[model samples]
Target: MNIAPRYLGRGSWLARRDPRVLIVGLALFVFSVIQVWDLRILVGLALVAAVYYRSARIPFHSVRLQWAYIVFFVSFIVLANTILTGGDLRDVKSQALHVYFRMPLLNTPLSAESTSYAMAQYLRFLSMAAVGFPIAFAVAPGDIGPAFARLGVPDKFAYALDLTFRFIPSLAADMRATIDAQRIRGYEWEKKGRGPIGKLTRTVPLLVPVTVNAIVGAEDTIDAMDLRAFGTGRRSWLRELAMDRTDRLVLAGFGLLLLAVTAASLTGLTRLWVPPFLLPA
Candidate 1:
């Protein structure tokens, strides 16, 4: 099925940047986004995220499945938030709210303030996903470890991160193979169950073989590392990464952005903004 997230091999602006720039910039962007609940600021951030994501030139077809998953997850969270606590009432500046309608059965009042809060939450998550997805779908697999190593991450941790990225696709491939084998043996995953227990039981067929393969893979990796005397002494990366002028400029820009966002948040300039319509006159 080729469902794993792999580099799209596109020669786009973001792809041209150093991997470290993307990693550090993404962290700064995430931190900045999480500091505010204002819809205006969040809208601006979401636009920036959209631009950043577009710069990677990732085709929609390549990541449609991932997009579907993200949309479903985010929608579920927003719906649950609306149903449960009525959407973070703390962010509403005024105690009084204009009730729009009451949710059936739950009788939860769907007020304008709560609706706006849910919109803010939705934008918050979408913005994060926007800038974050490029890292997985754009960066070259070979560069991950060296980039992290160059960033002063410990050698073992750097290598582990590299392995982690590559492992996901490998694991997915293994799972797909296992599923295919099961299907050949007359197993139907969809027809196996109906409820939560059915779902759990259905996974058993896929999980067991995949899990055993993963354990074997891990042992093989360990043996290979031992043969190469890994972690015994100072480790050297096969690939060398150096920051260019563009990379330096990007890092400085990211640093300044983080500082500016922190100042704005601490100075209370980025407080949640409730729509005037939501307040009773």
Candidate 2:
């Protein structure tokens, strides 16, 4: 089942740039987001990511599934943090009634501080995904190994990373094929009859076939690579990834941005900031 459409297109400037540059810039961007525990700073980074996504021509719909995953994850984080981090409930009494319900059933306390903390963490994850998804879609598989190699990553590890990106779509397709094949035989795993345990029991059969097939495919791939003398010595990728003028500009910009953000964080200017709207006078 090919669940995702290709978000990368030929016309986008991001698609034309070097993957190594994207990887390095994205690392710095994530580092900036991590240094400051502030929603405003994270939102600023998200806005920057939005502009990059637009310039790359990656439509939101293309990555809607990824967004769904992020939403689910963020929900979990919000719930977990709200419950686990204890604070006085009186701090949030002035907010609307819905804000009161943000707490869980674990006899957990809620306060403006806790709410801000949870939100800051949630936005941190969201901002990371916002930047990450674009890079994942924009970079080509063939360039992945070379990109990592240029980063001083070991050749074997770089090749492994390249294969991982190349095979993810194929693995998804294989899973879909297996499920369809099973369904055609009057076997319906999603028919909604089973409880959790029963559902797990029903799913095991599906996993067995998929696992076996994947193992076989992996063995074949390994054999092919061995025959080609892969990883035996100095390895060259099929395509050479060179840092061009555009790549240099992007890298330099990211370096400056990283330095400025780090300086602000170290000076405590962007630490523990909660928007005024979230605070009660």
Per-model TM-score, in order, reads: 0.89, 0.84
Cα-based lDDT at residue 173, candidate 1: 81
> lDDT per model, in order?
0.84, 0.76
Writing each residue's lDDT as its tens digit, candidate 2 over 195-234 gives 8889888887689998888888899899999999987889
Instruction: Give the backbone clash total of model 2.
Output: 1
TM-score of 2: 0.84
Error of 2 at 149 (Å): 1.9
Question: Tens digit of lDDT per residue, candidate 1, span 1-281?
Answer: 77566788358888888899899999998899889788888898899889889999999988888889988999998888889874347745334667777888888788877877788889989999989898887888888999998889999999998898879887988888899999999878888448888878887989998998898779989999999999999888887777789888977976887788789899987776777867656
| Model 2 worst lDDT run, 10 consecutive residues | 89-98
User: Once superposed on the true structure, which residue ranges of model 2 sit more than 4 Å away at CA?
Assistant: 1-7, 88-109
